[model samples]
Target: MKSPIFSRSSSPLNSHSSISPPLTPRRTFPETIMEENIDYATTIITKWDLDGPTYRKMSSLFGDDRKEAKRFIEGVTGLRNAMHYYLKINSSSEKLIRAQRLMQVAMKRLEKEFYYILSSNRNVLDAESVSRGSTRSSLSDSLEDEVQGDEIIEDGNSISEADKASLMAMADLKSIADCMIGSGYGKECVRIYDLIRKSIIDESLYNLGVEKINPSQIQKMDWNVLEAKIKSWLQAVKIAVKNLFYGERILCDSVFSSSEKIAESCFAEISRDAAINLFGFPENFAKSKKILSPEKMFRALDLYEAISDLWPDIEMIFSYDSLSAVKCQGVASLVKLGESIRVMLTQFELAIQKDSSKSPSTGGVHPLTRYVMNYLVFLGDYSGVMSDTVADWPLNAQTPLPESYFSSPISGGSAIEDPSSAVTVRLAWLILVLLCKLDGKASLYNDVALSYLFLANNLNYVVSKVQNSNLGLLMGSEWISKHESKVKQYTGNYERMGWIKVIMSLPKNPTAEFSLQEVKEIFSLFNSGFEGTYKKQSGWVIPDRKLREEIKLSLAKKIVPSYRVFYEKHRGKIGREFGVESIVRYAPEDLNNYLSDLFFGTEVSTSTKTWSSYETSSESSLSSHRR
Candidate 1:
């Protein structure tokens, strides 16, 4: 997925320690104080654990409906304290000791910084926060991120005080969440939460079932018996999951790279639960209302066999609107229902298939079928080329990558060669888009954020100007080559969208069907744009009328009459509206300089004396200079 261009890991774990607020080394406080903090933290965790999923609903009990605001605030404070003690206690080992000292200092600094940040009163969905479910890391700076970071230091009005405060708090909240879920809560804890949640929902589902047909009246049941049955079902679910995902399948190739990777990831980075619905139909579940509803059936059938016998819609995201009627939408929930239904329906398929085969079918290939074809073309050897980092990504199943992740393919590839550059450009665009997206889904840029930094400083335009220059490409190439900074976010985003869509169309979860044109029209940018951009740019210049004539003649057999989509888009009416050719001709020197600047930052400074070559002159300027 495309990371924001300006993502800075606000977490103390960020490598760029100079910019980040320091973490206090968590030394053991007095035992009494440590005990109190632990008790408070445990209490809050217990409350959160018990509240289960309705914590949001219960938010109004506080003066404001800021869900768990007080608890969250207290938790933040207590967590810091507990972390201090935990670090202190674990500092006996050499490795743990070093980590403790670093964390100790970092936590103390963060505590002070956290307080400073919370004083602001605005929502903190700005560019500076939010990435990887949590926010803040040691990535290179983008203008958006740099400006935000600089604002705090410079007392600039890039962000309102309120917004800044919110961001600070969110950073802490996000960091803590990541640490807990990663090291403390763990997958087992998450599953336990899921089990409990499912038990509650199952009870409700049972009640719904009983209203239609009580377990007691089914001729073989009583209340305790039903309760026992439901309990067994819960146990079975846990067992099934343990069986399905525990060993080889756990480590198999998925969307994510590792064993503890996102299960739905392999189906293409969609949520694991979503993958089940997309690819695997609970073999036993059919039209049984207990597992599948008519409405759900309509949605799941969206991805069923198309008019083409083999092809299926490979990429189509089911929207919230599509799932409006589905009671719940998560892998665990879907699995619980689908698993049970599949077991029950296996026996009755013979009867159902007999009746279904008798009906005559009017047919045209479905949009999903086309999508699958498109995906195979797009994926092209990407799997073979995928990074080995998948093994390094620890288990994280609770959250899925956001749907909005987008980047150019050129960018994703560049990221492989050079991660820093990848982190830079992609993270920058991501933060800007995300900030814009979050701000009321507001105008894409606000005066305070994107617009403000743009106006406040000309850096953005400078970056763009350099980026457009021919020499700029040279500088970029060099920068990436030397620093190995990757900037390709494109490939990741395309695959993510493709997988999400494919999974959505499956018969597992009820989601609406969409056409191939609809899918491509919406997401074509991610998959096709980057590579397409390269193809278009590689031989972009017309070279001469001869070349144009030659191309047209060569393609005449298959070419459409129009050149709008192909040649003209890049040519840009060559008169006053300049295009790549213009830059290539008059500014190759400057462009190389620009690329160098982008890649090396200020490290590889260049002077006009070196770049001011005869090669940079227009034809008229060259003639005049010659005279």
Candidate 2:
């Protein structure tokens, strides 16, 4: 035992152990995490253009090899430079006038094609007895041919004399977007693209000029089913470009070292435009220098900015004192268009990609991330090496690329990753809520479905944005509280005083997103009008028969404000002057506000009548009033 006691000098546990059993193996975590990082190089070629996936696919076809794409881009850059030179020279000379005239003729053909689209889509041109077949005959055999023949008019002879007249009437975007891809004429491409994309919106502007729908008419619109198609179409592209933009930017960052400029410019352009459109047009944007940037190629033609005529006829409707004449309807339409633009923008993006593929280069383009990392270490010395390497970034081609790009991950996906879209969307929701607020009594039956759709989309966006944030970033941390506060204020307004107040608070227990399941879940309820009039009438608190049994309970704290207003207005005429008999029945809840005023506004104290006295009160009152 003494020898055994001396045997454990290095271990204290030897002295403490009474009975030693077999030692259990100690479990430890592995020192190295065996994660096989997959090489995404080939797959990521599509991810490099932050503009979008559609853009990647469109541009990826520029060539099978580097040489073809570079050669194509060189020709494009040359064309752009030439156009700029022509414009500079044209500015002072009659040649400028000549260019304008040439623009007009091109526009006229574009207009004719647009009418053809409208004619094809609907019988709007039924006034002309034009069949779809006849229209196709006049244009091309199929929709593709129709689209191509109408838009791909490449030669100078296609230019005509309509430039002196207003160009707004023409559907020029289809042409401009095509030219951007087909010709590689970037400057003129951007210019005409701006006009053309905006021209699509001009149809809505023109629609506003049509006859107005009264509040009564809107109430009967059956907004739920009425809005189904537009809602679906709107959602189709709303998230597409943004999503593709993100994936592409991520790939670009991963793939090349000089993608910094392309990515940054893409992001800056998207952010600038998203902010402007969401917040309502900046009054001075037209005068700003950014108007000339590549991102605005489509936006330069953004008709939404110029078209205030579409806003609700606020000046005529609301007296400036009580209500702000926010073009309530116009606000909704513009937002809808914003959603629509995102979709149509897919075409514009696709065109850019297709054109970029025509250009070729011998050396491989650097991935975007390495470009950023090196620039960071060198403090921009490495940036000079990137020059003439990355090729035509959609945003900045000519100007000396920014020294150290701002918004390095500039792309659609990155833009969405920012809280910018959510903020813009919520602001749009705010605009709609304000419109609801200003409508007053007339708003009760207004088509609230669209408002709900806008709100739900934004809400979904917030949740989507939040998911993008983790331990590293929180959605609310990115100054999204500003957006929330702004949106909440508007939603609050509608809740306190308007219909949206009720709709949002409708207890999500019932209403849901428009999925197949929700439709199936609510269809029976919908047939019973649960989603329609039932939802509207849910606000009225029917005083129990017991309340009528005792006046005290009837006039309790929860008396509908409408009844209180009605009671107040008639209190003087009925309670004081006419002895509460002449107009009591006339003060129904229909005039809730006025009724609330009548009761609460006056000196009558509320108390419960005895059950026995309830009968006597009505009879005696009638008898007394019979005089």
Question: How does each model score on lDDT?
Answer: 0.30, 0.29
The TM-scores, one per candidate, come to 0.19, 0.16
Q: List ranges where model 1 is wrong by over 4 Å.
A: 1-74, 81-86, 89-179, 196-627
The sequence of per-residue lDDT tens digits that candidate 2 reaches over residues 1-627 is 376545666465765655677997863332111000011211232233234355434433221232333333333333333334456644564433443333333333233333333334332222122222222223221123222322323232332223201111112222222334333333343333234323433333233222223334433555343233223322322232232223223322221113344333333332223222322322222223333322332231233332333223222322122222233323444444344333333333332232211100111111111111121222112122112111121232222424121122223564345443333222223222322222331223244432332232233233333334321122233334444454454334423333333233222443223443333333333223322433443332212222112322222222334334433433343244432342243333433333232211111212232312222343343222111
For candidate 1, the 10 contiguous residues with the lowest summed lDDT are: 356-365
Model 2 residue-pair collision total: 62
What is the C-alpha lDDT profile of model 1 across 384-501, one tens digit per residue? Answer: 2111211122222222444222222344455456533332333223223322222221122222222221121122222232344332432354432321111112112322332333
Deviation from native of the Cα of residue 497 in model 2, angstroms: 41
Task: Tell me, by TM-score, which candidate is best.
Answer: 1
Question: Candidate 2: misplaced stretches above 4 Å?
Answer: 1-180, 199-545, 548-627
